[model samples]
Target: MSISRRTVLGGLAAAPALAALAACGGSGGGGTTEITYGYIPDFNGASLLAIADDRGLWEENGLKATLQTFTNGPLQIQALGTGDLDFGYIGPGAMWLPASGKAKVLTVNGVGQADRVIAQPGIDSLEALAGKKVAIPEGTSGDMIVQLALQSAGMSLEDVEKVAMDPSTVVSAFSSGQVDAAGIWYPMIDNIKQQVPDLVELAQNSDFADVMQFPNVMVTSATYPEENEATTLAVLKVLRAAMDVRAEDLDTTVELTAKLTQQDAEAVAADASNGQYYTAAELDALVGDGTVETWLTAMNEYFEENGKIEGETVAPADYFTFDLFTEAGK
Candidate 1:
């Protein structure tokens, strides 16, 4: 479904105060640059942006930024395609959409191994899941985890009885023994553990870390970078500053994000703990060493092989740029 800005903002009465867009343009006569940014609504999704807002980094950087929340990355990608948003944060799953030439990635915000292949107590190994029924939310990172784990065990989805289930219902089905195992992600992982105390986590994304890497990214419209180089750099600097704040004081960071997202502090903290974030220097190193590129390319290749991509598959260089990110840190 196509989500319009009005439709999205209709129910977001509790969201933080948004800055007014500059009438003249992004910036003029020493006035702050105005930018509309789209972001995901979860903790991992909102942390950096929330922190930036809470810390006055946007204003400090001479920006009048407005933050808008999207239910998911694909919707954000849709908005970007139409030029409704200048920039946005998106998950690895929606990263493939940018290959269609709608948006371009700026930098990696996080590398969170939040997906896992969990099994029943007796089902101790991935190999043992060969004939067992496995619950999975198809087309998610959780599903990809299942595929990679089975591949590691010299098996495939064909070897198992695939039970496609919604993420919200997976725990109930697994607890009732309706499925022998489940390809799941966190928050759900925590809940399932409470219900099935003996749940066996056969594999998580970290287990396949060497071959697979899926990092959440900050992105902009495909032409935003070329048209607004200084503004983009300013935004990156603010994000980098937020990263420093996040690394230094996680408690405050979590609190601000919880408030912005209107989620429970404990749940937000749990989600934050499950993620892997990089500092400005670390991000630079990853970009310089081709680590981030390799990860993005791996993600692209996986989606391409699965026929998830709609158009011609694009390489990392085609959609990602770190030139401004590097300059921002300086």
Candidate 2:
């Protein structure tokens, strides 16, 4: 699914003018840059925005960035594609879908190796899920991971019924035994386990460290980097600084994220700690053929084989460009 430059530019032009207006404003001068960012509710989004606002990281880099919170990654990616969001923090699955000629990736934020597969009490293994029902938010990264985990265990979707449920409902589903297993992220994993003492961890991203790194990335439209490379690079610099501060001061980072998400500081800290922060070099290593692009290529193949999309076999490079991150790293 290699969208032509004409198609991408046309898509950008077709988007409402208000979306472009919402994405950027102001001129860079005296070391000041203004960019609009789209974010979601989790610790990753909250903490990144908090660090930029509280620690003055954005301002320090002459950036006056404002964040608009989105409900989910797909929405954020949509906004990014429409030119309403200069940058966004989203899951690998989100990146894969749109980046397959549907959207593009600007940069990597942090890798998320923390997806959890929570099961009811007495169900300790993937085999135990056979003939039982599972719950997951359909068409999300969590869902894709759950599917992969099942396949790795020699099971298929037909072996068990899947109930499409939100993350918040996972606990109730488990408590009432509506679903035998739930694939979700923390602190939702933590929250569910707290409510159901018998809840067990069947598998998690950490278990599949060799196969994939669930990267939570900061991506933007393809036109953004070309039209506003300087501003885009400036934003990434600010984000990199924020990541450094967060890695060093976990307590403050957690507190600030907690304030933003209205969750407990400990819970936020737990989530932050589980994520692997990326330095410029770390990001480079992660994306070096073995990471994001490789994973996306596989996913696209899987989707095509499974008839998820029509004749759209997209290469990973079609959806992402490492040049901007490379420049920003310098």
Candidate 3:
């Protein structure tokens, strides 16, 4: 089944009006498309996009991209739906948007296994966190780590005393012994670890990799892929080039990521080595061999089972514009 804005927004009946507005925005001189790209300026989430912008990769690839920083993925999705953003570098927690036909995941940038569930040494396993105060950024990938780990331990968020706090605050609270455990991501995890010397890592995304894939992904509005195929492919090429830049120079990439995200170079350095960054060929192989489909299918199923996605299940093909990546590889 094809998933497009048309399908969710009443098919062709509503396309013309939205298309008319979308067309008026992305035009640029010299045969370039001026697009507004959204990204979360948190270290890992913003790394590649930051690298691309820092190195002028967007302009180099023939696009005039106006980089926009979003506080979170939901806001980016909201912008995409409203035609404010042409593309977004977002986290996996917002994958539900594509599954619900609100957006389309263009490419899985990399495995952001940076999120972790940590406890104050005594609380050893995920199950041990039951009835303990656990700070979590509600509705984030970090929260996903907590819930998925708890599910494996036969517990749920209800079993824990949930403390809803921002990531930085979670680090402070967990460090000060106010929360027994906290759902957080690096470099905040790194920050809390320094203070709480014997912090026990209860779980991380890699531990649940067999059941779900939590990766940083590139997404656009449901109609963007259908209407701007060439521009989308150009963006992918720019991302691939950015990955090459990142691989060729670790020191520079770290510095750029730290600078762009305004994070500490040390913390960024510590967290940088935590996840896998796939090259274009690697991404092409993942999609070609069905690994991409399998991972996303698992992710969608997990979201559906948790009531995070409503209505009928969205097949991987419905939400993924993987063909664009394949074309970009060529």
Local distance difference test, per candidate? Answer: 0.78, 0.66, 0.74
lDDT of 3 by residue, 4-69 (tens): 100111112111110111122222434656777776655555677777777777666677776666
Better of 1 and 2 by TM-score: 1
Backbone clashes in model 1, listed as residue pairs: 26-33
Per-residue lDDT for 67-157 in model 1, tens only? 8877667667677778878888777667677765678898889887777899888888889997899997766677788888999999999
Best candidate, TM-score: 1
1 against 3, candidate with superior TM-score: 1
TM-score for each candidate, following the candidate numbering: 0.89, 0.82, 0.85
Which model scores highest in lDDT?
1
Runs of candidate 1 exceeding 4 Å displacement? 1-29
Local lDDT at 105 for model 1: 90
Order candidates by TM-score, high to low.
Answer: 1, 3, 2
- Alpha carbon lDDT of residue 120, candidate 3? 93
Give stretches of model 2 more than 4 Å off: 1-32, 288-292, 295-313
